[model samples]
Every structure is written in structure tokens, then in C-alpha cells.
Target: MLIDVAIEKVKGLISFFEGYRETGFLEALQIAKEIALEMNIDATFRKRRKIKRKKQFDENPDDTNIAPQSAQESFRVNYFIRVVDQAISSLTRRFEQYEGYQKIFGFLFTSETLRSLDKDSLKSSCVNLEASLTKDKQSDIDANELFVELKSLQNFMPKENIGPVEILNFLKRHDCFPNASIAYRVLLTIPVTVALAERSFSKLKLLKSYMRTTMTQQRLNDLATIALESEVLEKIDYEDIIEDFISKNTARMRMFK
Candidate 1:
């Protein structure tokens, strides 16, 4: 789906480039890179094949003897390469999009409400996003204004660049200015990733040598979820969340507990 959209974007820009030389060339190149990166072509195929082959070999010692473990090592290397390629591509696309958005949308989010950003500032936000994804917590940087700005732009024209005060006024008159408050609330509001807890348990291995890798997968999962969600989860009753989830996913109470 993302690929299709990117392809269309490229196609759309093809003719539009006639009037724009360097700028168009650069933007089009970027779009092409993003489209290529977002295309996770090998994930499904490689994962399935790896699982299937492992299962088949497990079921038949004779078959495993035929291929040798060396062949499996080759597969592992190839899978690793694909993973690295995908990660690099993903990072490139993210940084590009963050930069692109800043070029197009930063005007709407200047001042302390949003940090005054240069190109480096946009790059800094991307770094923060990556650290947050990997560490699963907010980075020290001020990104709330930028985040709120992105959310607000969801409905606005991407190609347009209006002033910051104009945007604030639009939101204020329309009762969206209070988003500033909401954005502040979300800085540490949710468990967007499990990496934080994962890192913590990984630290546990340091203190307990016998349990270096002894933690079961299920136990690890539970630990990570609890660590990340503990603060917010403790504050709110589960019943309310269950009710909200049920309300969103079902039409009637009979479908929920």
C-alpha cells in the first residue's frame, strides 16, 4: 500500500519536474528513496521460508544431514543482510520525512512552544524518535510542539507553508489550541515501545550470572510490558480501559466482558 502511494507520487512528480530543476530533482530523488525503503519486500518471504525450513529439518534428521549446518549459516547471513538493508532504508526514509516535514511544516511551530529549529534541529528530532523507539522513552529534547504540529498538519495541505501564529489562531478559534496542553501530557503518557523494559531486564543479567539468558520469552514479554506500562497503568483502573476498548471495537456489551 505504501509502495503504491510512493509510486503514484513519483509518477505525479514526473511531469511537474519540467519547471523545477535542482529542487524538483532532489525532492523526486528523496521520494524515490523513501518509496524504496518503505517497501519491505523480503520480510514475509524470508521469515516464512526460515520458519518452514527450520521445522522441516527438525522433523527429519536425514534431511538436515543432507544440507549440513553450513548451509543454514549461509541463510542466516543472508537474512542478516536483508535486515540491515531494511533498517538502513527505514532510517533514511524517516530522517528524510522528518526533514521534509520540517521544511514544509516547521513554520507552523516556531518559538518555545516548539523549539526554533534549523536543519540540525530537524535532524535532532529524528535522533530523538530513534532513541525513543530503541529505548522506549522520551528523549530530553523538546519535541512536544513538533509532535503537536505534525498532528495538526494531518488535515492541512502538506505542500502549503503558513505562519506559526496563523496556525495557532486557527486551532484556538476552532478549540484546538488547547492541544498544547494535551501534547505536554503525551510526553510520557504511553508505552509506545517495549525497549525500555527490555533494556532493564537485560541489565538484570549483569547482577545474576546464572540467569544470563535464562529468562523465558513469555516472562520477558510480561516484564517489559509491566515496566513500561506500570506508571500509567497504576494510575488508571483497568475497567475504564476495558470499557473504552470494548466501546471502540464492538457495537454491544454482549461482545465484551
Candidate 2:
């Protein structure tokens, strides 16, 4: 995913939540009233028992006629505004990592972005990438080697109608550009969301049931893989598999043929 684009989306959501916080009270009240109307009931807050306490040492005891909050005011202050504030705060906190992600991987976002970089900028990007990935004196790729390889790679790749996916495919076929391959592999394998991981966990609940108590770990893993990857399994040619299964010997091959 494009880091800048993702960051913009997160910002947009926060802005929307802020706008809601400012002007959403009356609208929320209206919706509550409408729901109450549909149910043939009054939209009202339950009255609390009035309590009296000693005034503060500096306070006037004569001032005791505090107006109780109306249901609209109570709900607005207690629920609507608080919920919207939480939404804004949570959004800001959750997506803050996107900015750091952009800094590390922004230059490799697209084919056009990569191709447009001048040599000096590209070299700087490689150096920065090396720094980000370096740990305990080990590095994924040599920055200078990656710089030279990418410069040579740009000359032969198509100017349009391509992105990192296509570039990775090229690397796969030729097995050249080791540094570029590592970089692109890391770039492409970044998890955009946790939905797939969540789904795998969900699948485990269904796959390892009471009846499957005795299943071996390896067999369970294989079953989970096949069950989760049913889309890929659907596209496989069953006839080819059947033929291959049958042709295990000369007699079997002759019979199948």
C-alpha cells in the first residue's frame, strides 16, 4: 500500500470525527428521539435523587438552585462527545505508525516514483534503507551494490505499465539483482492488514474441534493450509492431478493413456 495515501485516509477519518464532535450533538439527539418515537416512549433521562452536602469553606451556602441537566444535554455531554473524542484519539494513536513506515519505504512505493529518482537521491535512499534494516552489525543488503544494480535495472525495465510486483516477477525469472530482489521482497511482504492472520486463527477454531483431538500437529497444519487456501485449490486442474496419480508405473501409464 502507498504509505502517504494510507496516512491521508487516517487523517481524513480523524477530521471527520473532529467535525462530528463539534456539531453532532443535536443530530444525535434527533436520532434518539426518532428511535423513542418509533418505540412509542419518551426520550428522557431518569431523574437522580437530589443530594445535599456541606458547602466548601469559601462557598456561599445560599446558592443551591443548580438546574438539573436535560436528557439531551446529559446524553450529549456524557455519551456523544466522549465517544467522538475517543474515536479521534484512537484513530490518531492507531495510524501514527504510517508516518514512520512512509519514511522507511516511501521511495519504493511505485514504478513511477522509483524511476523518477535521480542517482544521488536513489543512493541516499539505499543508504537510508540499509540503516533502517541494519541490526547487530548485520545488514540485509549492501547499499552501494543495490544502488548500482537498481541503476542498471532501470535501463531495461519498461517505462510504463509496471510496479514493484512486475519488477519482482522479473527478478524471479532471471535470478539476478540479489540486492534489489531482497529489497523488493521485503517491500512486497509488508502486511497491509491483519485480516488474513485473524482469519487463520478463526480457521483454527473450526479446524481443531473436539473430534480432531488426536490429529498430529503436522497433519493439522497441512489441513489448515489447504482449507484456508481453497481459492488457489479451485483453480488447479483435477484431470492433470488424476492422470499423474494414475501414471505411477509403466502399466498404469499405458492404462491411463
Per-residue alpha-carbon lDDT of model 1 for 31-149, expressed as tens digits?
A: 65577669943322122233434455347666556743444345435654455456556545544554454443333343332334455555455445434434455443335554545
The whole-model lDDT of each prediction reads 0.48, 0.83
Q: Candidate 2 — what's its lDDT?
A: 0.83
TM-scores, one per candidate:
0.21, 0.79
Scored against the true structure, residue 238 in model 2 reaches a CA lDDT of 97
- Model 1 global lDDT (CA atoms, 0 to 1): 0.48
Q: Which one is best on TM-score?
A: 2
RMSD of each: 22.6, 3.4
Error of 2 at 34 (Å): 2.7
Q: Put down candidate 2 lDDT per residue, 124-206, tens digits, no spaces.
A: 99999999889999999999999998888777677784767888898788777999999989877776667878999999999
Task: For model 1, name the residue pairs that clash.
Answer: none
TM-score of 2: 0.79
